[model samples]
Target: MHRLILSLLIASLAACSHTPSVPLYRQLGGPDGIQDIVGRTLTRVAQHPTAGRTFKGVKMPFLVDSVSKYVCKVADGPCVYEGENMVRAHADLGLQGSEFDVMVSVLREELDRAGVGDAAKNELLRRLAPSRRDMVQR
Candidate 1:
């Protein structure tokens, strides 16, 4: 009886250890998927007529990497975002509401194009929505 109880306890512990919920980063396809989305979004945004102005003369690779890390952190992934905060980062850009909207639209399109599930996409957007005020400088 003692051995049986010990075995049952061990089995339950193992099961619990293996049953951790998946993080959003994994749902977004891990590091690779997040990088792809950020890269494509920045590429298209840089080429946009109205939104392109902010990206003028910016280095693409660095921006992509930084933004990817930031997004991963936001999604509860194991990434360290050492970049500036939203308000500090965009403070000098003088970003308008229209430009911010364009960015959000492009991000939505990229998320859809990447085949992200509706739930994951919506969750990410919901998590990111609060940052808009810091990004859009009136």
Candidate 2:
């Protein structure tokens, strides 16, 4: 009986290991989830006088779509992200590292609220890593 129980436990563990990792989009609730996070992050940025000015008059729809596309692709979804590369898109923003940090904080909060897991967050970070060069004015 003990041997049988041990075999069962091993099988269970093996099954768990074989289960594929969840994608960031699915973990965060897909399109709707990313929209929610983007909205919250935008609101937080807008509420702050200093940070708000950076995105003055910038509409959220475009931003949301781009984010959703990229995240979807990164998270193993089937969408193709065809948006402009970060350097070309944001090169003129004159953003600083501090400003980027603020955005990261707000992003984390929104993701946390949306129930994105740590693994998903890490994946998002990896996907967004390249944007740093373009996002930061140096």
Candidate 3:
């Protein structure tokens, strides 16, 4: 009886010590998932009346790839973003507060469409929130 009790205690301890290690990137579904969210968000934002003007003359594929890499990096993934900083990138665009808000709304919708959980979606948005000050000049 004592031996059985000891074995049970040991098993319980082992179970308690096992911690799952899931990164935020994996929670957001990794590179492919990040790409999907970024692409859909950009496409939607480009169609929006308030935000579409910012996308004018931009190269879609390059912008998509760059934004994907940025999102992946922000989500704690393995990709490195090689694009310009947010401020420098948006310096010429003269973005307004409403335009930024429109993009955020579109991004939130796309994230939902991609089936990302509320926790992951909120966390990603929280991380990216600081960039608004840099992107929105007006």
Could you say which candidate leads in TM-score?
Answer: 3
Give me the runs in candidate 2 sitting further than 4 Å from their true place: 1-13
Worst 10 residues of 2 by lDDT: 46-55
Write model 3 residue lDDT over 111-137, tens digit each, in one string. 888888899889999998999999988
For every candidate, C-alpha RMSD to the true structure in Å: 3.8, 3.4, 2.7
lDDT of 3 at 62: 95
Pairs of residues at least 3 apart in sequence or in different chains that clash in candidate 2:
none
What TM-score does prediction 1 earn?
0.85
- Give one clash count per candidate, in the order shown: 0, 0, 0
> Against the true structure, whose lDDT is highest?
1
TM-score of every prediction relative to native: 0.85, 0.77, 0.87
User: Rank by TM-score, descending?
Assistant: 3, 1, 2
Report, for every candidate in turn, its global Cα lDDT versus the true structure. 0.93, 0.77, 0.90
Report the C-alpha displacement of residue 27, candidate 2, in angstroms. Answer: 1.4
Global lDDT of model 2: 0.77
**Candidate 1 clashing pairs?**
none
Angstrom error of the Cα, residue 79, model 3: value is: 0.1
lDDT of 1 by residue, 10-122 (tens): 99999988967789999899999999999999999999998899898888999999999999999999999999999998988999899888888899999999999999999
Per-residue alpha-carbon lDDT of candidate 2 for residues 79-117, written as tens digits (9 for 90 to 100): 788988777777778888878778788888788887888
Q: Provide the lowest-lDDT 10-residue window in model 3.
A: 20-29
